[model samples]
Target: MDKILEAVVMSSYPNNVKQGLVRRVIEAAKQPMDSEQCWSMLELSTKLYLLGDTKYKREIGKEVLEVYGHYHPEEFEEFFNVRFLLSLLQEGYGPLGKRSHYVLDYIQLGLQFVLESPSANSIFGLLRIEVLRKVCERPSPKQCAKISKLLIQHPQCIPVGKHQVLFCQQLIRCIRQFQCVSEGEEDIMEFLEQVNKVSGLLQRIWRTQTSVILPSLKELFTIISSTETRNDLMYLVFLVTNIFIAGAHPCLAEEQEAPSNALASVVQFVPLELMDGVIRNLTNDDSITDVQMMTAIGR
Candidate 1:
């Protein structure tokens, strides 16, 4: 590891560069090594990335990905430290309207590799979530939404709880960015329907983490309520109401407080008729006791 680091440091010298050492560093990085050696190669990769030369950066990125793939998925957690990889992947967010195409491509490449690999274990899923979370910081909204949908649909990929809530927040952000212009109306409505289908999953997520997911839920309310067509609005109403009902279940009484707060946030967007329907639906459900019904009505 020291030898690798020393070679990298020496290659950093001015015009009197050690091309021999640089070649050797790259060669050594390609071979399987202990964690320490992987760490050193990663540091070298970061330096290459910082140079901002497209060729060098892409080569380094590919090399790193290949190196990662060498480790078996079941043992991946023991071999590579996720924090170190995350640190190396970071690129400062560019100004608004500017995109980090290079960084995004590298991340997507890694994500694709993970997704296509034979293993759908929680570890790969966790890493994918981390990578996706970074993308959320400066997202290409539509692309992010597509990736989120893929991840959500992947069986046994994303672990529940905090990761799910975090992903949900980003998914909401992506949805909120749609302009709803007529030119893109079909695509926009399709995207909204896809989101609606996932409401049960989102509802379960909300039931467990109501407080953490409240803001995103409220944002979703605003997005749905702002739909240009009444038909679109009515369709979205089902999604939001389904999510709320999950938390309102009698078994989840202990989880109801924060969702009630979220209900308050929903009032601003919900039409009177929609509210009446939701209330009616709740009242008709035999599973909800009178106490639970009145409590929901009061909210």
Candidate 2:
């Protein structure tokens, strides 16, 4: 680990030359390493993945997909390095497609490896944060869901609650980029699945930090429950129910009309004090019904 860190963070050459972590990562990623060494470099790259651009960072290796390194230039390059490490695995039984599939499997495995690191609280935050950012960018739906769920479950590993929220937001944004029927059953179900993924995340983040989580939640939950075509009332019922069940604040910027009796029934059991900070956070949310205000006030 120290040797890998030295190669990445310490100057590998004399006179404190321009070469450092970025240079070393690119060099290491450009060529395949032995299995043991390759795995080490892959983990090192994951550690470095969450970093911002250093003063002299280089681009990723050519074999990696453009999207992996395109997010923020050098910081995301380690995603490429992870892929390169997977490429080094000596294939013994798989066809070309299966090999590619194994690479994805290994990358996912490597991410899990780092997330479980004992030092994650001290140093893995940025890396985990970056990996989530990349995972959100273009991973398949199941991969995105799986990784996001792991992230939500390991809030302690993330350390920074805001970063955890960022992961949720980015993943939601990426999911939105694909076409789903606006507030249709399928759309609602998919969004709720992600809601389930982040249920623990919100519990860990929302109550104490309403101010930090509200903005992203507004835009994200709005997209989930009240898309452009969401003209029905029942959908709002399901959406608010999911929010409350997740212990998240019900913040719907698009619920222009007062919620129907159906929606009110969904959230009736939730205590008002639990929701006060959330209501305060949504000062601009005129969409909140008078019933909601009274319900919280009555408590």
Candidate 3:
């Protein structure tokens, strides 16, 4: 048993470990291995050793950054794997509080890797959106600006995913909400300009045959309308109205406009009375609560 355990440990580190035997051993050990044991194994791995010391860690981090920073599609899977491992380590070290600075350092390193990589802009754009969703439960203006910049710079990078629209909508909603609270009109305007810029890029991508996984115009409209602020409503109206004037389909354009804005425009009109009627009905419904409102918009 002792010899077998030693062999397993030794084999685990060897580059040429027999896949069948390794799999069998790992499966057998799974039930008995506690967190400490698992961590010990991880620590013993070459990957962890590389991650442990500052100089070596930095070198690895630099390599990863180079891969991700340049928009290298070939390195996507490798970067994702490394990022996943780093995230796991970050989570593992969280209970240590301030002592977890090293974990954060590693995370920052991982981020740097993403930031410095060739295909980084898109990857970072996606990552920033995800990070913002969690960090911006109630975001600051700076965070909003940062996210806005990302969206503006790498609009096509945002892949079509279940959460993509929700993240975009949430970010816009948060920026609008922040604007309302702080009366930051300039900030709001800046954000809107970026949003519009990104929207235009998305439109161009939509029109192109060679476009990568860009979000559809309908998806953008869905997100814009789903945001949870009066200001967001106004902005949505503005965006839709502009898109309509740009010669997009009237129906699709009208979908994002506020009832008032839609009614005001002859080019793409919806009746104000009907809009008010819908709003009145929505207001009267107790089931249309705040949570429901967010859920509805998110959908």
Candidate 4:
């Protein structure tokens, strides 16, 4: 019985032949193998089949996932992490008729697994954030707004530190770009509020340091200058200036020094002429137009 099971596990046969052999082995066994033993055999068999033929791997992964799901939800991660799924995604498998739905479902299931596992939640969150960023490449206003809402709703789910700050900055840039293309002022305001809320959360988490906060602020200022809408650009400038002032306020009572360096970083990204223009605007003595803003950046 052990020899037969091993033979079946190691077999490199066509799908029909493999299925027939597996069925025959199951039927001939005097006693049923326990779940773990059965699953182990199945995993080995599936891997063998996948190795024999790359084209059949997705089918094999689907069958393996189904069997694993019957045994335990925890197996979802293992099954979904199969190299086939990643390969399929990289090879643009989604647009291939029925196969695309399978790929999409697998990706969604993988995300759901991540969301449900406490230990894996942050990993999953970062994965989702990356997916969202990819989706933003050519997204509609509606899609961008939806992604922004997801980020805002689960800011704390993202692990703290430089990566989280970088992700948030990317999200903010996406939202600002979406706003620029669509002229969505209300959406932009809502995104800003979300950023402020998340910044507050970071402050609570990383007291006495603006390490996370500074990157986000610099990105926000960059986006404001990048937006071509005259009114929106000026509004964002005003908003950021106010935020900077608030950061510097003595009455704020924070343990850390204000992030003066963050402001300098923002200024560095702005072209020298733009820096001059911004200073002029702050003094309320400049007549810088939108074209001048673009030209100031040598665009």
Candidate 5:
């Protein structure tokens, strides 16, 4: 029934087509329908007018969202809003494929909506992560810092399963870019951001019980552990791991009761031969040692 009515709205009307399309949806939205149909009609109405500069679409969209909110308010609102904003992004791309400010606003609004709503665990976080990755690719330092920091704090922003692998890959790419592009003081700051990003990634590992992130983790370790690599990067990775470890450094005995110590988990992940080489290289280098790191190793 809903589909048949939707087809009516979607079909061409000879006169006052725009207003007619919207009127039909509003009439449909007022009818008795299932939750899905109610939501769909609302979205269809938005499609007709959201891009208009006037309050025309906004008012109708709000009414539809409100009506849907009466059924499964939180989930329905967020789901519909995300889809609507993504559509705007699709339409906002310019003739030359450059990101338009219109789209940026949509992205920002979408992210804000995600932040304000309850998480469906990592589902929303992944959406936020994808958005952040898009922003980072364009390399807006200010926007990157803002969004990354927000994602770091979001419990759902955890890098796990496939995301853990993706997070590491992107971090490695970021580090490589840092190496090529940074110089002097800018180098130091960018390196610090990378370090924090690594630490932010670290938070995800605790909940991750499987060896899923291992391959990419090893790749990251290889880069940071290599002797030819910069000292700050090495120290950053070490610091990140130490910070993420389960127990406080001073209370070794207290930490020992758990069979799965964070330090041990990491130790088990690193191949023994690679570990030896990293230790061997560190011995020959003048890089500063992290005392907390030794404690984690001791654990």
Candidate 6:
């Protein structure tokens, strides 16, 4: 019966009448609703997205999001359209008022779909990069933390390509812009852990696409420059130096000359003052071999 009503309203009613009905239904949805009533209203609200122009589209999208908040749909992609949600995230996030609160949830959903699909090498790759770039542009503390954790926990999930370099760059940008290493030991440790994963990922990228990874080294330097506290600064320099060393180390005999040149390129970006601390930290780390230290310092 509800589907029949939707078909009739969509096909028979004039635009103005349908608009009026949509407004009424949206207003009515603000009141308390049982599960069945909420489901019906949700369907109607989603359909209204197809009914009117931009004005009604925002209205309908907000209404559907409200329903989603109430129910927390298990199959989010199935319950609501991912592309439509991405459009709202791209354009309507600010205008949608409180409905924009779910931006993180939608971003995660969008990323998951793109990563799980077989064609991540194609348009989905671009889509993930765009979505990540958007988060970096206006990163909140929570969003920064979430994205960092995602990168740390699932670095393998990100498919390899130039997109991987872009993803790492933006993730580093997010950390540099929004994250701070607090005084607490746990906070500092977590920050280091995140940095470790980021640098490890970058080292891997550098090994595969040494040419493309140069731009990302700049982001790594920004993370060190943006460090607020002395402890954080030292730790960032140390970790970043290791990333440079790993990148500069020759894996094969043919690339021996290239390793020193690569390390020189990276060294040029390090702050002159921090060079002392980088050497100090590398010396302090008992795990670092004499050859690695020489490679890092002499080159």
RMSD of 5: 13.8
Q: How much lDDT does each candidate structure score?
A: 0.45, 0.42, 0.40, 0.43, 0.44, 0.46
Q: Highest lDDT: which candidate?
A: 6
Superior by lDDT: candidate 2 or candidate 6: 6
TM-score of each: 0.39, 0.39, 0.30, 0.37, 0.37, 0.38
Q: Candidate 5 at 129: error in angstroms?
A: 7.4
Put down candidate 5 lDDT per residue, 93-171, tens digits, no spaces: 3241224433443333334334545544344644555554654474333333444554555545544566656655554
- Which candidate model has the greater TM-score, 1 or 3? 1
Q: Using lDDT as the measure, name the better of candidate 1 and candidate 6.
A: 6
- Candidate 2, residue 264: Cα displacement in angstroms equals 14
Question: What lDDT tens digits, residue by residue, belong to model 3 across residues 190-232?
Answer: 4445434433433333334222222222233333344343322
Q: Which residue pairs collide, candidate 6?
A: none
Candidate 1 vs candidate 6: the TM-score winner is 1
CA lDDT, candidate 2, residue 198: 37
Error of 6 at 53 (Å): 30
Estimate the overall C-alpha local distance difference test score of candidate 1. Answer: 0.45
Candidate 1 lDDT score at position 277: 56
The predicted structure with the larger TM-score, 3 or 5, is: 5
Off by over 4 Å in 2: 1-126, 135-140, 153-162, 174-195, 198-200, 207-211, 221-227, 230-235, 238-274, 280-299
Which sections of candidate 5 miss by over 4 Å? 1-80, 87-147, 157-159, 179-198, 203-213, 221-299
Off by more than 4 A, model 4: 1-75, 82-92, 96-109, 114-160, 179-211, 226-299
lDDT of 1 by residue, 186-220 (tens): 66555444334333344444555555455554455
